[model samples]
Target: MIKQMPFVETDRLYLRGLEEEDVCDIYAYLSMEETREFLDLEQQQNIDQTWNLLYEEYLPYIEKSLFQCWVMEQKQSGKVIGHLRLYEEQQCLFVEMLLHPAYWKQGYMKEALMKMLQHVYTFLKHQNVYVKVRKENKNCIFLLESLGFQYITCVKEMLSNGKMYNMWIERLSEKEWRKQNEKNT
Candidate 1:
């Protein structure tokens, strides 16, 4: 089994490996119609289904070292607000993030993402980290672009749901990240 990763802290938030206690918070989002729109869930009827999915589907991926999920909590309020995942596939790291709808537009996600990117690049030594955002998620697209990610292409018939969505890929080399940081100093 893969060793459990440690908690990561940012300026305003803390990210730690998901625990069984997080089922309720996760279910709150997973069961929401608005949040499920871009996600792959067919439907979540009850807490038992959510619990099974979290344990059976998601936990196994974590145990196999194929994916890692982190629960995002506000440092000040100690409230669980969202989740972020790093998926290892085809020798690449794919990032997936979701925030509570109530916390949208507060810059919390950018803070969490910035910290995650740093950890993935500097600590994990992963050179190529990518994210796939829906074509209509303009807010997320703009956020990624502002973080130095460039537009790659739109993927057609990319999802199993028979929906064609835009796919934007970004690569951050260690050298590039260092140079970018130097400029900010």
Candidate 2:
């Protein structure tokens, strides 16, 4: 399949293709205690561990699958602050994002997420977008809810790291997105 690269521009951030160089930036958050607290994996202890996860695991799976990652960069400093992954699974487009703690509460993630939601609606024409978050990830839950995603149900799954998670699945339908956009306009 031919890849159609996505270049999404938001007011405060730019969503561009994620490269291998971004592994370090991604590890900045993945290595943190607070960020990993709700995540299924233990906090990364070294760069090698992060590299293995990103290179040996995720990269291969993403390469063969209908998935792409966008690294969020600050337009002013050109610093990578986070990354997001969009993939198709079970007939739904799924979006997952992670942001550095230093940049949290600044709305960058929200900006990137909004842009991708529009892309899914416009380009992918997906009926719904789904996201699964740990129930304890209050910040993520709040962000999803604020974006008009409805709580679908709770599910439990075992992570690759041998940990189990109680997650809340949420979804934003095309109808719901259209409704939200109508209100905004």
| Best model per lDDT | 2
Cα lDDT of model 2 by residue, 56-158, tens digit = 6456654676466778989988888888878667666778787888988888888888888888888876789999899988889998888899999999989
Which portions of model 2 miss their true places by more than 4 Å?
1-5, 58-62, 161-163
Candidate 2 structure, TM-score to reference: 0.88
Strongest candidate by TM-score: 2
Clashes of 2: 0
Residue pairs clashing, model 2? none
lDDT scores of the candidates, listed in order: 0.75, 0.81
